[model samples]
Target: MNRVYNFAAGPATLPLPVLQTMQAELLDFKGTGTSVMEMSHRGAVYTEVITRARESFKRLLNVPDNYKILFMQGGAIGQNAIIPLNLMGGARKTIDSVISGAWAVKTQAEAARYADAAPIIANSCDAAGRFVSFPEFTTWNRSADAAYINICTNETIHGVEWYPSDAEAAVVNASGAFLVADMSSHILSRPLNVANYGVIYGGAQKNIGPAGVTFVIVRDDLLDMQHPLCPAAFNWRNVADNDSMFNTPPTLSIYIAGLVFEWLESMGGVAAMAALNDAKAKLLYDFIDNSKLYRNDVQSKYRSCMNVPFFLNDESLNAAFLEQSAAAGLAALKGHKMVGGMRASIYNAMPIEGVRALVGFMGEFERQNGQAF
Candidate 1:
């Protein structure tokens, strides 16, 4: 009955309360005598689930009335093509991408397939192909008639985050382009002012629930711009018109996400979650900063609260570190292969005690390894 503190980047840990709720309703959901997964998506039971989930999400994020929350099937990668396909109809053929890391780079490449031109506005990688920091907003070369400007608000692999600032908003607004963000890693970790961007899309696996469900909140005005060739299923307008039911939705994933939304609400919603996440990030980052053996490369101002990527000063200790951490009940501390280090993803389900335990384990590991931390 032991549960390790899981830190996988996505399809990551979920709240125990949410899991319990799902278990309780697994066989019979609200007197229906059937699992939500066993029901028809078009049935009344499913309708209630979708409605409550959307409304809970709206309340939690304070999403505006002008935005439509579409529970989609494809992950953020799907949105990369779907976004341009839907939004590039009337605007110029060019799409501007601000590349911050691997995810953003992948997004730009995907956008190229849909748009006539996909221009890199700013690429943050250095000659060694390391993502150290975000390019300054002033340094970007935006297109005059660009269909939209795309940015990954938090680069999960590189561990960079962009807090919405007036300068950033002004820059996007001045270009007369819709601001689209891939917020996959840090979607529900904090409060977002939805009006600041035209579209915000993220896979639910990280901060929300299980895989197979993605959420896209698009401003209403951006719906009608889809190209004639856009697939009916991928078209935002069609998805919206059908209320994200054009095809059979991901029922189990959506239902689990609804349970998570309810769990979040019971725990005092996103504002409270943001405060908790801030404390958790600080706990881990401060330990990394002060430790002589471990180092975090991301610039302090842009470091992600959800994903903290750090490297051991002695690269030889990587395997031992992971093994000992696993033995101590800390799981998935391995960093992405592109970045050879350790990454601790402290998502919503990661309690403060988990971070404290990890810090303690790191200290013990350094001492046993004869390194001063």
Candidate 2:
């Protein structure tokens, strides 16, 4: 059987080893003669699955003991509301958002409902509404007493990412506000100093496993500040007390994510993964930079390692390029509707060979269509 290279943004491609493990355990997981999907979440078998998943996640990310890893049902969009609900109970009800792209803009809008949401709009977008760079750290006016400052670490649609450095950390710490990041698109692709952020959350679909669960890592101290209306299940403090089993939980997805965590460990963990991710991003970006036909608009310093959004110089060939790419075993090359052109979401599961193949296809398409205008 032939497997095409998949580049969907969410419910994205998963590591082959994880998929193989799932297949092996499907009929009778761990010799129990029951598929994980059919088994009870409360049973010892599934309990082990979740426990192992959490511990492996902790180890892989080097999470501090003070952090609680919660397997949740809501996606990032859910967290937009849940974040304010859980964190705005403090006397400081305001939530400051650092907007870089569409997701961050939406985050600010959602936070506005539950708290004093203020956005530090990035000067990163060009006059034509194109993202060309990231806002300078010094330019951000983060709220000093806000409950937390929300930022999307990587803007998938705009192909902009924040790779925090020592200088940036100092700026972030000086704000005297809790740092919360939505690392949905690039969570496991690199190593993050979990100490730098109050909350680190992402949907598991991109790098962990399939959809259905969003894994969250929240500092223990931040758990208690939930609004009065916050649901018991959505409250970090309550979810922590219940061990993420307050509800049925996403059993099959958790089980699969556990396999993925183990797989990441076997492949030398996040540090090694970061190195590979760097090489993959560089290979693709180098090609795009050299090709007059294709160009990535995001500033080089802030370009995403996971999602690379590029446009062909000749817009007329967009549909045909996608059609030809699909025929060549490349799927989901279409960019988000908000950003016209093509986006290649090369997540952890997307091997280097996939990017290489994609570059080859782009080259061939360019040659056939006409020279770069």
Per-prediction TM-score to the true structure, in the order listed: 0.97, 0.97
lDDT of 2 by residue, 1-373 (tens): 6899998888899899888888888898889998999988998888888999999999998999999999998888898888889988888877787778888888888999998656553446678987767677777776667777778889988889985566676676676677788999988788888888888887888888889999889999889888899998888887888889998899888988889999999999999999999999999999999987898988888999999999988898899999999999999999989888999999998999999999999988888877546
Question: RMSD per prediction, one decimal?
Answer: 1.3, 1.4
- How does residue 309 of candidate 2 score in lDDT? 92
Native-to-model Cα distance after best TM-score fit, residue 286 in candidate 2, in Å = 0.6
Global Cα lDDT for candidate 2: 0.86
Superposed model 1: Cα runs more than 4 Å off: 371-373
How many clashing residue pairs appear in each of the predictions shown?
0, 0
lDDT values for all models: 0.90, 0.86
For candidate 2, the per-residue lDDT at 10 reads 81
- Report the lDDT tens digits of candidate 1 across residue range 196-307: 8989998999999999999999999999998888899988888899988999999999989988999999999999999999999999999989888999988898899999
Candidate 2, superposed: residue stretches over 4 Å from native: 121-123
Evaluated at residue 120, the lDDT of candidate 1 is: 99
Candidate 1: RMSD over Cα atoms?
1.3
